[model samples]
Target: MAILTIPVAYLIGAIPFGYLTALWARGVDIRTVGSGNIGATNVGRVLGFRFFVYVFLLDLAKGFLPTYLFPMAVARFTGHAVPQLGVFVALATIMGHNFPIYLKFKGGKGVATSLGALLALNWVASLAAFVGFVLALVVTRFVSFSSMLGGLVFLAVYFGRVDDPWNQEHLAMSVVTIGLFSLLVVRHRKNIVRIKQGTEPKVSFRKKHPSGRVAWVLIPILALVGAGAIYGLAAQANRRSELRLQPYDLTEVERVGTGHQRTERLAYADHGKLLAVTCPRYNRVVLYHVTKAEQLEVARDLELEGKPVAVWTTRDRLYVLVRPSGDERHVKPGWWRAFDLQGEPVGQPVPAGMYPDDLIVTADGRHALVLTSGRGEGDPKRPAPALEVFDLGATPPQVVGRLEFDQPGDDPARIKLSASGNYAAVTLLGSNQIAAVDLANRERPALISRSNLEQSEAPHLTESKDDSILTATTPDRDAVVIPWPKTVATRGGCIACILPQGAGLTLIDAATRRLLGEFPLRAGSLNLGVARPMGLAFSPERGLLAVATRSGSIHLIAVRDRPENIGKHEHVAASEHLGRRR
Candidate 1:
């Protein structure tokens, strides 16, 4: 019974006070537009005093009635100590109201809900917490800080008064309330910092919406209902699950300066022991012996050719695939030629008249895979629109195989390669499908998964580790690695990316195929490895994962610490075969 109480509390807490309030004000869903918080304050801020009152009252009703009055009803009907359970139920309601699961578990803080619970537990104590918040805000001018302290005060009120009318049997609840309140404070720790620094804005009752109702007549009533509704939901006994997450920091062990664009390309070889980076601005290849963390400018003399598109280095030679521009062809749809590290041409350019935007060289440096049409950033126009597999060692590429999808039906911008050359994952844009191919039989790659594409975006393969399909998700930009490590076989899978909106990264164990956890953005940087985080590179020598943003900052994050959403699954690849002949 006690075990069940926590889930119940979470359910009760999930109610959207601001949402209901918004509806009462405008007869519309608050989340559909504006800042989508469904609290009484937002209603007061957006809808003014008249409707703010309606919303606050409705919210208070949900907050207070569920936790207070409902428990009484149950207690009277059962003729038992139902109020004994009320404490647990009320706590659950507060959690549900703050962080609901049904609506992506996103909700406002629990002040109104807590007020409702306190009213149900003891009106005298509830009044004390309310006054404390108002007074603190008046003095410190920090609403968040006041809320934090007010919550503490509410928990504090139960302690000193054993003779108080409702103080006899609320120990379990007192502890739980304190714990939840602490979590809230921690989550709002940033706000606390702002408050301390005098940067936090005061809670203004001033109206900001032109269509909003009058402010003076609205706010108080909404607060009243917010209290009531929360208690009422508690009375109904709602349940919810809990989530725990830890934050991490991003460290850079090595970095190189370079200009960047959205369609940046990278190639790793020698089991990712060698990371080769090519930038249009640098117009050359930068090689790093990842393990030693040593970097070298192996070749910068490709002046006659286009910027480095894809690079691979064998033990004795280097092969680079370039899509030449400022010519008859556009940047992404231009000529793709191969050159040795000595700046010597290896083979005929892949296409006689067209350039390739993307490339993947074979493990032995014997072949080069090219993707055109899906070229040049995310323009969606001027798509080179074809696949060309070239023999890297050939004077001009020896066409090994090719595939082309109809326009609008397939926008193949994202691609991946397995170490065994057994599969290729393609993100078919303008649609939904994680295109899987059988690379084992080079002439014809078969589709293994097409219907279940969550989002086949920013795809990568653990080329060094052998067999994992790694893809970046849209919306959240999470790196997901699905492995078929048992043997070198092409496996079929569905399409998917980040999900449930606003949820953190979901880690899946390749072997068990179970979701490990929702990994948070552990790195301290405001953002990286996500949202058009166009570049990721793992340097085995440095034990670092390079995360790059379009704005031109590269972060070398340590992979060992298990950063929240940083590293990709298919860590590195071999490029001896993709380079010039020894």
Candidate 2:
């Protein structure tokens, strides 16, 4: 089904609106006109100015529809990110306009189609391209010269945006940009020769009659005013749409004690009965009893030596992954500490990893999964983060097996062990992929497979073999991991989307290694601002999925059959905002 995007886009681009307009309006073939090309300029020579406008707009739509709308539809339908795939569709549309097979391999110069494509891909770059065209045309009055310059400027403007995700992950966008630029230059070869010989035809804005010149001046002014008014109204409408997101009522606010103000990670324990929140500021793990209404009641604070960064709980045990405080003069290392469900110390702290970021206990509480963010290049031996499995049945948890990533920068942010303790879904922030580790093999945990998230082009980095595949953008603070219910048919797990940049949640099928759906994070009454997903917990029995943000706002989304579809209610978690609460 996804294979038809390119062919469909190509057919749309090959419509030849200019040729048809010339034939219908003047009974003359546009290909034999002034420029001997079936484009807006040649068609305008044979047909009236009105016909030229109609032909140009039709040509533009051919490129715009397939590039802008079709790929998104396909991506949504497929569940996987077809980002670079969209670039292919865009390129195909432009190529069809340039050398259409329907016209016996002869077609327009692709300037209009390219403009439409760039406009759809990146509107700012398209505007920049238009400015280049207008500037060049006004100075030289040569349409061919202006078209070539516009295409070049479009590429330059689009590529210059180093910060855009599309320019970074989708390297194919660069290829298309260069291809469009080259196509324009190659198609304008005759005009280049004419310009060099000082015989290029310059467009005369004025007609032979005085009234035609007056009409031209009046028409441009009217068009500019109409365009401005339309733009103003559209901008107003967009603002209204943005604000229309329903705001959810504040549900609850769990505050920290004095000096324990900075809070970090959140975890569920004892079948969703307990919520253990890590507060590094006071080196403690604060436990809470979560009510049915999704409110947190402070249960107890378990103090630890090192700073608590992440926590996980079993039916009878509490596991806290702690990192050494920077103020330590003796240079204490990072380790793991365990305690009973009642918050009593179980045993002495054990050596976990260099920088433990997240952990997940198995359903039976016999094993655990830990994700450690690597200590950077300062240390050569432990330069990369790893997925470590711990045998919890032992007195102090023992590291049974480990799987480290090849890239030193592959910093793992979160980990989720499946209900049956079969697999551990690990989100690697640095690499932008979710590595699913098979935990069934306790003696040797293996990295069974991985799935990429939706990603934009990473333009700054050199292209690798894997760069062709589109993945999700990982914000510095984006981290959420939730395993699917064992009873549910869905294979793997889901994660909260990186907000503001890539807004939505991504659900992946662990069994097939396929994306089930990319669901938006929009709720009934809440507007998602710079809401980074800091924590995620699923209530399968109640069909509720709760997402906690660093903005101190927790959003509850209802799920039906799958995470791909959003539920009825979504709102702020607590009765009061975290900042306002005592």
Candidate 3:
């Protein structure tokens, strides 16, 4: 089905609108007319400007339709859209325009068709090329020269603006751009020679008739004004549609503490009625009661013996992991403390590893999965970064299973379980990898998949910070479940992984382990600016995702389940920052 688009696009482009229009209107072959070319320029020179506009639009539509519509049709049938399909369609359309089979493999120079294809592929690059074409035409009054300049500008802007030139996603498009540029140069070789020899005919705006001359001058001025008005209206409509289509809205941004304190983890419990935020800077676990209006109100703060690193909650219990303060060399074993909903201690602090970062409790509350990054010094027996599974039914929750990472400084940051508690996903900050574990066998959890975020197709995951002070003090990576709502037809859910180095969220399909998409945390008009998003929590009942940033503010984003809004939301690119870590 995808391969058929190329031939269809070629056939559509093969329809020589200029020749058909001339034959139908004046009963003359456009190929035997002025310039001996059946292009819009020749049609206008032989007939009039009106015929030029008609034929140009007809030609443009042929290129635009295939490039824009085929990929969508293919995606609807195949369940996945191949972006490279558009590049093939674009090339086939241009090739057909340049060499129409009906015309004995001879056709126009493909300038107009290429422009139409470019508009469908990348609008920004197309806009830049059009502007260059207009500027060159105004200066030299040579249509051929302007067309060549536009192609060059298109290539320059397309390649120059990409953040990662060698990205696999852009490889096919890059090859297409170079091919199109070469085609333009080869096709316009005769025009180039004529221009160099000073024998090329220049386009003249002046007309012999008085009314014709006046019309020419007024038409351009009015066209510019009309185009500007249309562009303004389109931009306004796009913004309105974006607001309506977006699933989330930033309702409130409540600061956790003094606005300078770093908040690490967040967990919602009691069916989204209670919120727990672990603040390591203040050495306490702050609890918030979620109001009916979706606003957070201070419930209570549980002061701990050590700095609280991570938090989790069950139906009637709150679990907090605390680690000792100061340098890694002097760091001692951390503890996991349990409390009731009212902030009262429920059990004695259980001794954990040297540096326990995050944990998750099973649905039945029979087991607890803890992630510990053993980076502490002065202890040769200090356990390596590992995922420890404990039997919660046993006294003191004894460790029943353990899976230690082979690398020394993997620095596993966060761990989260699937909705059914059958699988787990962990983010390894130090190694720049995300590991998926199969928890179907509770007694023996097994590593199923491991993906390096930096090398993955997910965009903006390569950027990393180098400031050791920030790295040591702040919580950087997190993973939260975007549960599939019962209201929506889709059966499976997605995982939103936050990469602090990139300051964006990478969405992965939980069932297939495929990367769905990546989007920046730029809440444009809502002003919910996120910098180094440290923690995330999702409420299935309310369809809300709470993001806790390092700057000490919690953002509540509502998730929508409307079928129309599933994959239609716009994805904005995140701005790049300098630096990298090993």
Candidate 4:
């Protein structure tokens, strides 16, 4: 019953309203015509602006329905209140719009879908994104550029004004929403190329078509039906389950810095005896000695060539990713350096991709994997999404092999290596796919397989959203989770719009190079917080998994225990407040 919700939501979002509208209005495939896109923009260009508005609203509904209405329906049918499940449904809806399985896994740019989802998830941020889009569109007269800029604005506004900006509560949601911006930027790569070549088309405001009556009638009918179905499900859910909001216990919460500097990344090193945190504004890695009692004291700060973005540590060495400073004209495009345990330079700086964001070192300290985002700074055409493997056994860990992807902006963002270093799994953020490489053979790493994290099955209309009443069998004990609602509220905003789920983690079999499964982390979990998993470190000695969430806290999970037994400890650079528990 609980599992049926995501797939059902995906199917609902998979409807190609724009493409269908264009095909019905005129006998032309929207993908083959202007812009070669099936989005509302392309549909509008082929048909008319008035028709485009209809398609846009419908596309937005695809995103809105699943997040706003589907959750209540699932909760009603399953008799279980899964609040964080809405995040999964919302993401699935956006994913369906971007990569609809029915379209042979080829879909739109997802700007409209993401905007709609954002509206459902955070109206404030959605409004910001909308404003950015309109302003940029009016100024540039280019939808592609405006959409990309709008996404960036959305990120800025979301992180700036949403709750406590630097807390762990918003970290996971921020990471996920930022990924939406990345998706938009990556998808619009070709458009950027066209703009640079001075060949991009400017949007034209055309008149409305006279035959838009069908769309108007159909859209209203569909909305009414969707609303009624949602209401019915809500009644069922109300009768079955009661919302039980439990409180999460925090082990300890302490401020890190002076609240002036931002805490970017946290890592446990020296066999979990030392904690390394990257504070970019401070332009240094602050080392802290962790006592057996879990108390942290400032050890020292290692100043770097530039602002540190990420860090990886071995038995006796530390690796840092730094973005060159503006005045440092001598620094090359590559960025990464190695240092000894005492914070001494190991040798020369290692050459990496355009923008290296994440890195991981094997337990044996014999190999290291670096994800170079390849998306060059200041230039959209300079995408070099690549994975650089280094032989750590070498004097300064020489770059042994480089693995590149065929996709233009398929940047390997988050990377993880197995405990034994037998295999490496990388999340290609741009494509919503994961790639596994056989790292057993260090000299020549082999690409094992690439799997899309998102489900590949195309969503199909399973039931009528306008179904006024459900059959008696639907109330049966074994009935599947019905997706429609009896009544959907027409109010100020959506319920989940202001609420978002945390980031999720998926497991991959290191030896087999296959994905095991996905596990929901933050949000709806017993841990009532958001987790932006920046780094993963497994300590076999302590039987604990140390996760460096890009926030003010570090989450520790017992490898041998259940998820509910996991704990989150907040520690910032601020030493003024210590030993505080929440």
Candidate 5:
């Protein structure tokens, strides 16, 4: 389905609006008219400026339709969004306009078509390029020279602002931009020679031609209005392509377990029907059954051979990390053991680093990542904190790669994989930073970027399904949710950071890294009625956020409301509580 978009784009772009308009209006072949080219400029020179406006707009629509709409339509039909296909679609549209099959392989120079495609690809760069074209024409009055200059401007501005060259979509767009710019220069070779020889035609508005005067005044205004409309459409398309956080009010559904048991982590399996909580102090994992009515009921407890630090769940298996308990803690190595959903051991334990605290499995279930603090108890030589990667398909899961932190006290706490499963974000508690690790090479994971949170003490981290946002818990009792740095920038504003300890969650704009807003976790000053909120999990299918606190209570918050419904719901005052379990 995605592959079919290319040919469709070409067919759409191949429509010769300039030639058709000339034939219908003046009974003349636009290709044989003045300048002997079937383009808007030649049509205006031979026929009238009105015909040029009509043909240019028609040409623009052909490029815009395929470049902007094809990827969106493909994504709607297929479950996955393939934005990289837009680049190919844009190139095909321009090529079709430059060499239309119906015109015997002869067509326009593709200036208007390229502009329309560029507008869809990146509106800011497109606008800048348009401005460059207008300025160049105003100075030199040479349309051909301005068109070539505009193409160069688009390439410069587009490539300059790319934040992530490693991103798949960005890389594809870069290649296409270079290809289109080269094509533009090649097609305008005769124009360049004419300009150098002082034989190129210049646009003129003589006193005898009132239509030229009217065109000089109306074209800029029309272009401005058209650019504004295209910008709005591009913004809407981008919003639809990405995942957005809906306007939600938290409502505590139920408090399932007792307090003070030190519930360290939570994992859901069996399609969100089973919830597993790890209790290191008790050396066991408590399994809960979530009924159809959304109530939690304890099903059973699985006792482990050692203290359970964290638990991860797949479709049919449960992996539990067990650390040495009592005096042997941090001295003996920890191990991860796999079990069936029934809590029966399936394979021999795989030895991990000393003081292993967290584990995350890849989307394919072919690899697992374990984060170990590597803190040695009174030993002269302490193992450096590291992220251990394993190949799960092996007979005995073997360690394929490892990433060790430079400092021994980095004390990495939690690791979370991005939506694409090509990257992982790790929280360095002792360093107050978050490390973004590239997992493109599964066997040789590399640290790509590290962001410091200044005074924030990082502990645990979670990511949105689209990898657009990352939320991390701070020991200061705040959950900081920031846009993932790798994502393209969108609408954002500054949010004031409120330091009322344990009061709420903080929102930060990923582009600026400034505080956005704080969402309090209290129902009329009642609080979550728990202290030290730690683990956080968002269930998109259920639209519920399960927050595990050290106080041993799980607070289920409803975040189900769509963004468009925000206006229908009353906005509660800052002093008032939003919602809570009654």
Candidate 6:
């Protein structure tokens, strides 16, 4: 995923929206002129209100189009859900605007990008969050407070379920994005505190604090909050560990109940027998028994005790997490750990705090591939974040090899393995490169780059059952689905359609290592917003293609007439529309 993310972040941040606005008006890089940051706030500081609006919109576009628009295009073209992946892509895009690699990795503070993220998720709440920030700015005259308070208020609105459609997975994503965004702002709390002291730089357009009474009210609230926490913890013996998942596929799946908050990843057991999903909300791992159509909380939160980010299973064994933990033995950080299906300690979690990110396992579950580093997590001081390859069958889950490029840091947006687990699709951020690695070669993974450098977010590689073909989804444009064959030899086909950016299923030429062209995927309808295809699986026996999206929609596609029926390349041909598809 980092492979594709580097270019996405670079290109998205390189947009120079703020700098361009500042330069067009004042002929200076916004960063050099104000706080020396090429972000909207910096632009607003230097360019004033009228010009800053344009900068803000442009900066928001850097976040919006890339994070939301781009992913929609890819989903429409590839017929896959890239939204779950889009979260990371959006994060990368935000990181790009905040700290662009082209600008020596120091860009803005990510306010605009975060606002764009909110907008992509839900326009109402995002707008409310925007109003919250504006209100803070209007009252306090402190942009930092406004920014922090905006996110906090948005988090509250998010957690409060204001205007949210009741869906646990969707809500989980909300908390995930909000928590991460809050952390980003929290890292700058010192600056926010300084602003409260009336020592930080103030935006000229904002008003002064309304009254001292508000601050007085805050005092009691803080005291009460602390008191509430103490009482809550005292009363609570265990963090709400009970979780029940209701599976909702378009056809045949039933939901017994819903999941608790903080859930990250989910995958089915053999023959979809059980759902082995990762729940970051309650900080536990859970296994849902599907036979009885009831969820049995098998194992709850079992990482290094930090957060279980991603998990994938083979059969009775599950390769749980691809994140770092406190190395009690090594006293180091950044590691990967594995647990059995029963949540028992299988092998010690590998430490890799130097690289903080996500991971994905191959379909066969034989190889555990790790990807880390993005935004603030990518540290140039230590070892560059890498793709640590581990052989799951090894007694200790031995590190067989790793994947890195000539680039200074990893920019992978998403790591995708073909349905058969034969090929690896890695999308690089801000660039047109998509490294197609062959799992057969563990020592040296091959690389591929697309032409035309655009802001492509999540790169999804898909394949059919019993078929060696694959396809790549470029999140930049929705008009054309570029099909890259996983054959590793020649460039392949490009399918043309009015598919939403990164939000549809696509065709693949698995033999040629090139795209076999694309067509509109029908039937699945997302609630709304950006529709990036999330996860995909093909039934070898049934020839059915199942695609799930972050918008909480699962689609069923049959492949009996897929080749001749699809790839005809007609936007009107698709039975599904972008609005419904999301």
Q: What is the TM-score of each candidate against the true structure?
A: 0.41, 0.44, 0.47, 0.41, 0.48, 0.42
lDDT of each: 0.53, 0.63, 0.70, 0.60, 0.69, 0.53
Clashes of each: 93, 28, 0, 19, 2, 83
**Sorted on TM-score, highest at the top, how do the candidates line up?**
5, 3, 2, 6, 1, 4
- Tens digit per residue, CA lDDT, model 5, 322-396: 898876874688999998877789989999878887888887899999998775222437688889899999989
Scored against the true structure, residue 245 in model 4 reaches a CA lDDT of 10
lDDT of 3 at 391: 88
lDDT of 1: 0.53
Instruction: Tell me the deviation in Å of residue 562 in model 6.
Output: 14
Task: Report the C-alpha displacement of residue 490, candidate 5, in angstroms.
Answer: 12
lDDT of 6: 0.53
* Model 2 per-residue lDDT tens digits across residues 1-582: 557888888888988888888887778887876777888877766676787788889888888888888878876887665536667787888889878888997999998888887788878778878988987776567989998888877776565442222323435676778877887898899899999999998776776534446757866776797599667645532331111111211121222121243345666666776767666655777777766765566788778787877777766788888888754512445788788767788888878667677666777777777777665323555646788888877876788888887664577776655545666666677567777677768769888887774454220111133221112333233434343444332322343334444555444322223333444433111121223455455555444455554433344554434323222321122112221331
2 against 5, candidate with superior TM-score: 5
Worst 10 residues of 1 by lDDT: 573-582
Task: Provide the RMSD of all predictions against the true structure, rounded to 1 decimal.
Answer: 21.2, 17.8, 18.8, 22.6, 21.7, 17.4
Q: Please report the candidate that would top lDDT against the real structure.
A: 3
lDDT of 1 at 291: 54
Instruction: Encode model 1's per-residue lDDT on 411-479: one tens digit a residue.
Output: 555566765667777666566555667777666655665644554223233333556656433222434
lDDT for model 2, on a 0 to 1 scale? 0.63
Clashing pairs in 3: none
Q: Please give the distance, in angstroms, between residue 561's alpha carbon in candidate 5 and its true position after superposition.
A: 1.7
For residue 500, give model 6's deviation from the true position in Å: 7.8
